[model samples]
Target: MSAALALRQAIHDRLAADAPLAALAGAVRIHDVPPADVAFPFVILGEAVVADWSTATEGGTEQSLTLHAFSRAGGRREAFALAAAIQEALHDAPLALAGHRLANLRATTAEVRREGDGRTYHALVRFRAVTEPL
Candidate 1:
């Protein structure tokens, strides 16, 4: 499978197996990628109120989460919390990597943005995971 597809599946499987993520139900859409980054759809696994995954590099990947809710302002807290939950969910391999575990998952940035007729709290978490070469 392609790196992106593999990354997506790994994320889905990990989240599916996670108790926290299992509470929601929705297929994670592999949305956009800018240069070296892979972005997950605003809606992931279900009503998680957040989307997240890792970068599919040749060697490894990096995890990230974005929040979507009623409005960016109102969703900020939920987003931040969900992002951390995602990080915790992928804390093992092959969900993560041998040496790669979530080193950080925090909202360093946020925005109150509009989504259709409503608004939602949007936040970003910086995920850092590392693994040795196979």
Candidate 2:
């Protein structure tokens, strides 16, 4: 598999197996594409941008991954809390990618805001990762 795909699979597995995160967002609430009637305080795997980072001797890739947390709580607190949990779960996480070596992973940016709908809060956490063929 491509490095980006491997890395994404590894991340999704890690997040799904995280007990603390499950406690906060509820089991089965993390999704690649959430259902139309998904529950609150759920996490969605968002966009991913991948770029070639190969050297003369080795092939590699750099990836930017985004995760979204949605909440309908009365305040931004729930969204922020979910974002923090996601950061803690992913930043510097030692994920084992299929057919690839995870060289590095880190949380790069995060934003929490009230959506235009005015009742929902959205939290976006972005991560950077480097991977190489194993």
Candidate 3:
């Protein structure tokens, strides 16, 4: 499996398994896109971009992942709280990738914005992760 795919799955699985994440979001709902059957207050594995970070003797990759939090708690506070849980869950997280080793993972930035729809809050968390072949 490719590093990007493994890392993405690892991330999703880690968040889904975290107790705090579930408590903060009433069950950590993580998906590339939330299922139509599901309601608001969930986490979306928004997008992932991978680049080569190889060295002479080692194969390395750097992945940028964007995680989005959506909530309908009457304000941005709930969304922001969820984002914090996500950051804490992922920052320097010890992810176990099938074909790769997670060298490092760090939360880059988080921003809270009221969606134009006016009924939802959008919180975006950017993460930088580095991986190498096992």
Clash pairs detected, candidate 2: none
lDDT (CA) per prediction: 0.41, 0.89, 0.91
In the range 1-134, model 1's lDDT, one tens digit per residue, is 43334444555666556665434323332223323432322433222122334357535434343433221335455555555556566544445423334333333333444356554444343333332233
List ranges where model 2 is wrong by over 4 Å. Answer: none
Provide the lDDT at 74 for model 1. Answer: 50
User: What would the per-residue lDDT of candidate 2 be over residues 1-134, giving only the tens digit for each residue?
Assistant: 88877887888888888887888777637788988988787888889999999999999999999999999988899888889889998999989999999999999999999999999999999999999899
Poorly placed runs, candidate 1 (over 4 Å): 24-75, 96-118, 125-134
Local error of candidate 3 at residue 88 (angstroms): 0.4
lDDT of 3 by residue, 4-79 (tens): 9899899889999999878878777888967888777888988989999999988999999999999999998899
lDDT of 2: 0.89
Candidate number with greatest TM-score: 3
For candidate 2, the clash count comes to 0
* Deviation in Å, model 1, residue 105 alpha carbon: 12
Question: For model 3, what is the alpha-carbon lDDT of residue 116?
Answer: 88
Per-model TM-score, in order, reads 0.42, 0.95, 0.96
Q: Give the C-alpha miss distance for residue 128 in model 1, angstroms.
A: 5.7
